[model samples]
Target: MRFSLRSCLASLLLAAGCSAHALAPRSPGDLCGFTEGRTVLLGNLVFMMAGKTTIQDGHNEAYVKQLYWVDLNTTFNVEGAIPPNVLHSTDIPSSAPYESGGAFFAAGNTVFIYAGLMGNSRYDWMWSYNAKDGTWSRAQVDGGKLNVDHRFAGLSAVAPESNLSFFTGGWDKPITGTVVFNATDAADTKWTNVTRVEGDDAVGSPRIANGGMDYLRLGKQGVLVAFGGYDISKNGTNQTETDHDLRPMDKINVFDIDSSTWYEIEATGEIPEARSAFCTAVSAAPDDSSFQVHMYGGRSRFRENATSYDDLYILTVPSFRWIRAPTTGLIPWTEDGVGRDSHKCVSWKDGEMVVFGGTPRKDDKVQKGCSRNYPPIRVLDTSKLQWQKQFERTTKYTVPRIVSDIVGGDETGKATLKEPEGGWANSKLQSIFSQTVARRPDITEVPIPPEPTDPPKSTIPGEEPNSSNTGAIAGGVVGGVLGVAIIAGIIFFLRRRNKKKNDNSFAAATPAAPPAPPSMYPDQQQIPMDSKDDAYMQLPGELHGQTAVPPRYELDSPIQSRNRTVFELDSSARER
Candidate 1:
C-alpha cells in the first residue's frame, strides 16, 4: 500500500501523544486536593476529612473543614493515567469548619467525628457523616447538656458491638479515665468515665495526646489498644505554654471491653521507639485467628523538636510481640523527600494499608518544612511489606473558601482561581466535587446499660493470651510433614533398588553435609533493650564526625521537671 509522508508523520505524532499520556504520573488532585487530613475508609473509597491546608484559604495556615474522597478501585495503581473523578470534594453542610487531632470512627455507613480543635479551643460538639447519603448532621444525645472538656489530639475507638465509642487522653488535662459515649441512645446519651486502675504513684497512669488507638476483636471479645502519644504532665497545669516538656509514651496499654479494665502489655521482639501523632490500623490474618496492629510515621520525641519516622512496625496481638516490618519500594525520607508525623492510615481487606497526609520532617534536620501542601498518598502492602505511591497532586487548583469559625470567617472571600485552559472545566470540576446528598438512614439509638453498682471482679487472667501460638504450631506441623515425606521417599527408593540389583555394583553414598542451622525470624534478632536508651549511646568512631550533637533544651531541669504526670480522671471531671 502506498503511504503519504504526511500521513506517516501524523501517525507517529499520534503514537507519541498516546505514549506520553500512558507514561504520565497519575495526579492525586484528579481525585482531591493535597491535604494533611484524617481519612476514613468505607468500602472502596477513602474519605479525606477535615485538615490543615495551604491552597484554599490563601494564608496557607488555615485548617479547612473540607471532605474529599479517592476511589480506591481507581487510585490503586502505582503507574497509570489519572483516573477521572478519582479525587473530589463533598459539600456537606458542616456546622464547624475546623478539625484537627479529632477522633474519626465509622460504624456501618455513618462516620462519627468527635471533638477536635475548631479554632484555638476544643470543640464540644459531635457530628456524624452519613457516607451512604453524604449528609452531615449534629447528633442529639440525652445527657444533660454533654460537657466534655474541649481537647485535641485525643484517641478514640468505637465498639459497634457494644454501641459505644471510647475517647482517651487529650491536650487539656491528663484524662485519668476513658470517656465512653453511647451513640445508640439519643435520649440518654452522655459521656461516662471509666476509671483506670492505679499504677506506680510516681509514674501514674497513661495520660497522653496525639496517640493512636484501635479496637481489635480477640476471639469473641473486643479489646481497645492504645499506643504512642505525647504526655505533658511534667509541664504543670499551664496548657498554652510551649515550654512544657512533652514526651512520647513508650508503653502499650490495652483496655478489655468485657472486663472494663486496663492493663499494660509487655511486648517482646523489636518494639518500636516511643513516639506520638502516629497512625495505626488493625488487620487480621487471612485465617482470622490473629490480628496485627500496623503503626506508621510519628514524631520521635517532643513535637517541636521531634524527628519524623517513616518506619513501619506491626504488633501481633494475643502474643503481644513486635515485628519491624522490612519494607521495600519507596524509602520514607529518601524517596518521598522526608518522613512525616501526624499522618492518618487505614487498612483494607487485601492486606494493603493506606497512609494519607501529615506534617513532613526536614532531611537530617530537626526543623520540618511546611511544604506538605500536596503530600502524596502512600500505600503499604502489609503481607509483602512493600510501599507504593498511589496518587499525588500535580496542579494547584483553587477550592471553595472553607468557611469556618477557626479562620474567623470565609477566608477565601470572593477570590477564585482561573480555570485551567484544557481538560475538565471549572464547572465540570465543581460538579465532580459536589457532595452526595442521600436520605439519612435510620440509626437505632439504644441506651447504654447502667454499670454494676458493686465492685467488679477482675477479668484479666494471670497469663497473657498467646493467640499467635496456634499459627506457629501449625507452621511447625506443616514443616514436619514435608520433612517426613521426603525421608520416606528416599528410604523406599533405596529398598526397591537393593531388591532388584547386586549391592557390590553400587558406589558408597556420600554423607550429606549437616543441614545448615535454620535462620532465625526477623523478630528473633537482638534489639536494644529500651527504645530510649539508644538515643544517648555514643556513635562509633567511623561516624563520630558526621553526626551533629542532639538538641537539648531542658537538660538542666530537675528529673521531676522532665517527667509528666499521668492521670485516671473521675467522671465528675467532665466539663459542665
Candidate 2:
C-alpha cells in the first residue's frame, strides 16, 4: 500500500530522534588542560633585586630598581619598578638618581613597600597594594621608624602571614645594635634594635650580601633563621674570627623576635657547605614536618674556580639545624632534571617547589656576562625530591629578580601551545561555544500515555445507567494502566536529560599529567645531621649531621629508563 504524506513525515521524525541519542560524550581533556585529579590554585613567589639606574656618565652611580611581580602560571605577572634609586635610602632625594628604595613585604591582602638605605638615612614614605585591586599607592607604618638604611638593609619576613616584615643585619656605624623592625601592625612602625652580640667585636662586623637576612619559623613561633653572609669585607672576604669567618659559620644562628636572645645550633650530622647569595624558599609540607627552608645556588671561594653551586640544603627550623639534602639522583644532574644556579625558587602548596630562570656555570662565560641558558621553570616535589619539567620560554628578564613576589591566582593557567600565551585571556570563540553548550540541556522524546476507556453507559445516553459495580471496576483498571505508562515515560525522559548534562560537563574539565608523590633523596639517609641532640630531628646544629640520600629512579620510570631524552638549556650541555 502507498504511504500517506502524514505517515511519511512521522517516520522521518522518528529516525532523526534515534540518531541524536546515539552519540557519546567527549573526553575531559578536550574540555580542560589540567588533569581531572589535580587542582590549580593561587600561590605567591617574590625575589629581591637592585634596579637599573639612568646614569649621567659611564662611571655614574647605579640606581636601585626595587620591586617587580610575576604570575606563576603566566610567568612575570606584575613586574616593572620599585621606588628607590639607590640600594639603601628611603628618601628619593633630588640628588638621588632614583628613590632610596629599601625593602618590600607581602602580607595577607597587602604588599608593603618600605623606603630606606644601608645607613641611618630613613625615608618616611611607604606604599601598599591590595592584591585584589592590582593597584599601588603610598602607605605608612602608624608609629613606624622611617629609617631607610635599617629599613632596606638585610631583611626577611615570616610565612603564612607575610605581615611581619623584619630587618636583621645592618650597619650601626659606631656599633649601636642589630635592629629588628615590626611592620605587622599596620598602625605601628616602632624600631626595636637588639644586639645579637654585644659590641662591634662581638657582633662580628655586620654581614650583608654574604647571606641575605633570612627567617625560618619553629612550630609557627617567629624567630630569625640566620645563615651564611659576607662575614668579612664588602669585597667578599673572611673577616670576624678567621675560623668563624673562614668556615662561613657552619653554625646556624637563631634570634628570638620577642626576646633579645641569640642561640647557635651545633649538630653531629653533615652541615650545608658554606656559601652566600644563594636563594631560599619554604618547601611544601609532605607530613607534619614544619616548613623546610630550601636554599639553592650561591657563590663560594671554596672551589678553585669561581663556583656557583647546583646543590640544595634545607633548614629544619623546629630543630634549628641545617642538613645537606640528598643529591644523588635529583641534585647534581639527574637524567630528568637540570643542574642550575642563581635561579629563583618558591614553594607551591600543591606539593611542589617551582624554580625558574637562573644562569648556569658562573665561569668566564657568565663572568663576561654572556646571556645564555635561561631554562624553563622546573618543579621539585617536597615528598619526592625530584624535578619535573613544566614550562619554558625565551624572554628578557630584569636583574636582582626574586621569586617570592610572583603571584599565581586561581584564574591563571599554564597552556603549552606553539604560540605566545595570554596573561588574562583565552580564544574568544572557544569560550563562547563552551558557555552556549553548557547552558543548553538535551531534549529527549517521551512516550504519551494511553487514554482511559469511557464507561459503556455513555451509549445509553439519558438512561443514567452504569452507576453499578462492574462498570466502575472496569473504569478503575483502565485509569490505573494509563497512569503507570505516564509515570514510566516521565522517568525515562529525566534519565536522558541527566546523561546529556553529564556529557556537557565532561567537555568543560581540564586535562593535566598524573600526580607524583613527595620527593626523597635517592641515596636514602646518607646525609649528616645531629639526630639525638639536634633541635630538629633530621637537621644538625654545627657542621656534623647526616646528609640526605639522593633518589634513584628505576628503569621503569617515565623519562629516564624508557628513552635517552636530552634537555638543553640556554647553556651548552648535551646527553649522549
Candidate 3:
C-alpha cells in the first residue's frame, strides 16, 4: 500500500462531513472558475454554475453549489452567488451540479437545468434559476413527468424565440427519441418525446459523448453544429480505459433543428490531435455568413499515461476548414503543453471565448522557457486570434480574421482563401448550410438571431449583471478585494483513480428519476477496491488530471479516491 501524501490527499476528500464525492480542496487561487460544469448565455452575461471548484472555503467543495458569472464587458472580473439551497451528494446535502452531461438552457429570465444522473437525487430533477433575483429553485418538466429514461452526455439545442429546446442521445447507445421541452408557459412547460427506433444509430448518427455542439442559422434554417466525441463501442477489448478512440475535431456533424436529421460534413485542414471530454464555444460572423467553433483544452488517454491539451482550434462552417488558433497566455503545466480538460467555454461580448475552471495534466516540466501563468478562467479574442490574459469587457465584436478570410472580409480585410472545395455538395446539406435570413436595416434581423442560438441561451434581455449585491467577485485570479487573498494558502489535488485490480469492468451509473430517494448526482458506476473493507467508487476518469478515455465515470469516493482533487503537489509520485 503506497500510502503517503498522494493517497493522504485522496483520503481527505471524504473528510467526515464533506461527503464521498468531495475532492480535496486545493489552497485558493491555484485554478479559476468551475470545471466540468454547465454554462448558458443570457444577454452579455455568461453564467457558469457547478462542476468542481475551490471557492472561499465556507462550504463543502463537493456539495457546495456555487454560481459564478462573467459580465463579459465593463470589467475583467467574475462574481459568484451561492444560489439558495445548493445541492450536495449522498449522506450529503441535496441539489449538486450535474457531474458531466445535463441539458442547461436559458430562456426568458430563467435558466433551466434538466439533468438525468446526479439530478435524480432531487425530487425536482430539473432545477431553474431566476437571474432576476439571483435565486435558484425547482422548475417542472411536464408535471415532473419525464417520458424518456435518464440520459447524460447527450446532444442538445435551445431556441429562445420559440421557447423550445431539443435533446437526443445518451451515454449508452445513441438514443432515437428527441426530448423536447417547451418553455413558452414557464409554469406549464412540458417535455415532448419525439421517439425514434433503436438500432438506427443514424437516428442521431454519431451521438457520441463528451463532444461539443451549438445551434446555428445556416441560410434560414436552424442547425446544430457538432464536433468531437467518443463512442462506447469504440472501446478496445482491453475493457480498460487505458486505450480508446479520441474523436477528431476536424470532422463536423450537422443536426438540422427543423428536420430532425443528422448530416456529416467534410472539412479540410490540419486535424487537431484526436481528443474527448474537451470544452467548446462558437461565434458567427456578424452577418451569419460563416460560423467558427473554438475547441479548447481536453484530454486523450492511451498506454499507461493520460494526456490533456492546452491549445485551441477553430472549425469554420461552409468552408468547413480547421484552423488552430494561437494560444499562449496560460503557463504550460506539462510537456504535453498546458494540458486541460473537462472545462466549459462561453462565447462572450462580441466574439471572445471565456473559459472557466480547467485541470491541467500533472507533470513536472518547466516548459523549457520563461512564461507567465494566467488564471484558470481564460479568454480568447478571435478578432485578433490571440489569447487575452484578462476579459475585453467591451460590447463591440470584430469579425475573426479567419472567418473573414474564408467567407469574404471587408475593405482592409482582403479574402484570400479560395471558395470551399465541394464540401456541401448534397442537396439536403446545401439547403441547410446555404439557408440564410434576410437582414434589413428597417428590421433588426441576423443570419441566425445571435440572440437565442448562436450567441446562445446566454444573452439575457436586460440590465448589466450587477454582482455587487451577489457573491464576492475575486480579483486578479477572477477580480476583486478577496481575489488573491482567498486562495493564498491552498494547493490542489485535482483527480483520483481506483487501484483495485481488474477494475477494468466498465461500471455504468444507473440513474433514477425524481420523487427523490437520494442526494443530487448524475449516474456514476460503483466498483470494489483492493481491500474489501475499504471500498471506493470508480468513475469514468483517471486521477491527477482526469486522463480517462471514457467520460469521467461518476466516482463517489466513499474512501480515498475523492481526496485526490484540486491541489497541485510539489513532490511525490501522483499515484495513478
Which one wins by lDDT: 1 or 2?
Answer: 1
Per-residue error (Å), model 2, residue 426: 59
Which segments of model 3 are wrong by more than 4 Å?
A: 1-33, 56-61, 77-100, 119-125, 135-137, 147-150, 170-176, 195-205, 219-221, 233-244, 328-336, 364-374, 402-420, 437-576
What is the Å distance of residue 502 in model 2 from its true position?
31
lDDT of 1 by residue, 1-576 (tens): 113433443444444444433332322222212333556664445666556433311223234446666554332333221222334455534464344545565454555666554434433356766554456777655433333434556677766554567877766753457777765543344566677564331123357666778877642346787876656546533331233434434366766565465665455557687766678887654433345688887755433353557788876555455667767875544544356665777765536777765555454232221222223456776655667655321111121122111112222222222111232222322232121112122222222222235422211101222456656645655665455445444544665665775342111232222332221111222322211111111110111011012321111111211223232111101111
lDDT of 2 by residue, 202-311 (tens): 22324443354455433223456566644433432323212223235455555544444555444323466666545566642222223356777665544244345677
Write the candidate numbers in order of decreasing lDDT.
3, 1, 2
Tell me how candidate 1 scores on lDDT.
0.47
Displacement of the residue 190 alpha carbon in candidate 3, Å: 3.0
TM-score winner between 2 and 3, please give it. Answer: 3
Task: Point out the worst 10-residue segment of candidate 1 by lDDT.
Answer: 538-547
Question: Which of the two candidates, 1 or 3, achieves a greater TM-score against the reference?
Answer: 3
Highest TM-score model number: 3
Tens digit of per-residue lDDT, candidate 3, span 391-468: 654434566655565557642333334235664455666666666533222211111111112211111111222346
